[model samples]
Target: MNEKKSVTRLDSTYMDQYDAHVERQGRKKKRLLRRLALFALLTLIVTSSLAIYHVQQRMVYAEKKEEYEQLQEEMGSLKESEENLREEIELLNEEEYVLEIARSNYFFSKEGEIIFKLPNEEPSY
Candidate 1:
């Protein structure tokens, strides 16, 4: 028992204290590395989320822009059609225009008037 106790005391040397100090330093380094890795991971997650959000907004903006262009085209067509209708209405209010349409379409004639609708010799198609 005395020999074993002497041997154990010999093992507890200055080297053991130095080894303990080295182990504590290694633990602190590992902890710091773990914290850095965790920070980098969180930063990556936040950056990825922002990128996804920006892509979604761009998609929405592109869709809205296409819709706006289509509406503008439709609006232009509608305005052109309205103008054509207004011109037709104006022409219909004229007596000469009414007479011409009646003569051409219905072959109408006045008491002394004669309407002749000659067929075209050329094919329409």
Candidate 2:
């Protein structure tokens, strides 16, 4: 009877130890899983923010590029107008050109010239 009781006690103690070890292992696994989930969530948030930033930068770049192209076109037109104005200034410096403009715009004729006013014919649409 004494031997049987001692064997039974040993068996019970072994079972208790096994149960405790299983509980510890389970807790460790749960902690590791929680850490992994937190890390994954952080990674997702960071990547999403970076993606959004890049998209915004691309949009801004497109708008700026369009503005630059428009400015280039405007500058080209302004340069052409400046050339035309410079030509007109040069022509105005000539005496003959000035007299021509005065006769055409002000209807001034040389001393003994007969002036005729003609009406323009238009289609009565």
Q: Note the Cα lDDT for every prediction shown.
A: 0.93, 0.94
Model 1, residue 67: C-alpha shift (Å) = 3.1
Task: Predict model 2's lDDT versus the native.
Answer: 0.94
Model 2: lowest-lDDT 10 consecutive positions: 1-10
Candidate with the greatest TM-score versus the true structure: 2
- For residues 1-125, could you state the per-residue lDDT of candidate 2 as single tens digits? 46654344455887899989999999999999999999999999999999999999999999999999999999999999999999999999999999999988899999999788777787688
For model 1, state the Cα shift of residue 102 in Å.
Answer: 1.8
Q: Model 1: what TM-score?
A: 0.67
107: Cα error in model 1, Å: 1.9
Question: What local lDDT does model 2 show for residue 27?
Answer: 100
Which number leads on lDDT? 2
Clashes of each: 0, 0
| Model 1 alpha-carbon miss at residue 62, Å | 2.7
